[model samples]
Target: MLVHVRSDGVNAKYNEELATECLVWINQVTGGSVNTAGDMDNFYEVLKDGTLLCQLVNSIQSGIVKKVNNSKMAFKCMENINAFLEAARQLGVPAQETFQTVDLWERQNLNSVVICLQSLGRKAGNYGKPSIGPKEAEKNERVFSEEKLKAGQTIIGLQMGSNKGANQSGINFGNTRHM
Candidate 1:
């Protein structure tokens, strides 16, 4: 019993209120450091980028193909559908069944995108937990590691020089004495 919001008549005041609330929540969760002053404006500018929407569409299309042709492939398709639905739910979009036909799923996905955009716009600030503190770099210790440079083994083709210029008469390279 998921309630679907119509995208055709989205309320501007509602969106603005949701966006402001989302910003406040984001500030609360992330300590107001995740986004710069104008980042939210930039986000609203690119909200309709359609990258994720296109990915969802492709997943649905592929799943539909698999469902019609091969049962094994269809299982993979179902997994894709389930993943999309789960992600949508996590983003506050309503439930959409994988059992539905591809056409229905496509329409539902489109609706889900609109819903997700609205929900995200409203709750973006509240999504993630604040960092406790800076994380320490991991140190790995290994026994019997391979030797990088063995003793008494000089790298070849390297030039060595003395500041006294006494060795300038001779072309001395590295530890090798060239006479």
Candidate 2:
């Protein structure tokens, strides 16, 4: 791959490595049909139609996509991508983690697509499915009794700062600009 100086440089360093991991994970989950996604262009070609993406999501949870369009029509392929994204969201992937249809279909910002797949992998792991990325982001929901809530109201929040030794004299900003 030729280096393009005027590109999104942030992910340029690790995008290839991360994309490779995503491709491996997708193949593992979807029965290994994808042959090669060694680079961004190849990755786009492999997933541009969205069939494999939908299949991987379906394998994670049956019928999440409802349907996967296999036609070559432009609309059909974009729909497939949309379907896959909806399914991924149903599987607990965050909305921000999914890429727009144009990103893959128009071959723009494919790195976002790679990130989406990586997020899907983590979400799949959370649901006890096969995953490829780091550990799933677990929710830590806390429950507080009424007493605890009342105690919290009495205590000053750290954001408000401590006012134990308050004074009337505060630094005035130019004496309030009196005429």
Best by lDDT: 2
lDDT of 1 by residue, 1-179 (tens): 24243455332213343444433444454333333232324333222222232243333233321222122354544454455445545544444422232322333223333344344333222333331222323569765534654532555433554455464575766797559
> What lDDT is reached at residue 138 by model 1?
52
* Candidate 1 vs. true structure, TM-score: 0.24
| Total clashes in model 1, counting residue pairs 3 or more apart in sequence or in different chains | 4
lDDT of 1: 0.37
Count clashes in each candidate, considering only residues at least 3 apart in sequence or on different chains. 4, 0
Q: Could you give candidate 2's per-residue lDDT for residues 88-124 as a string of tens digits?
A: 8888778998888987887767778887888888878
Give the Å error, residue 118, model 2: 0.9
Q: Choose the strongest candidate by TM-score.
A: 2
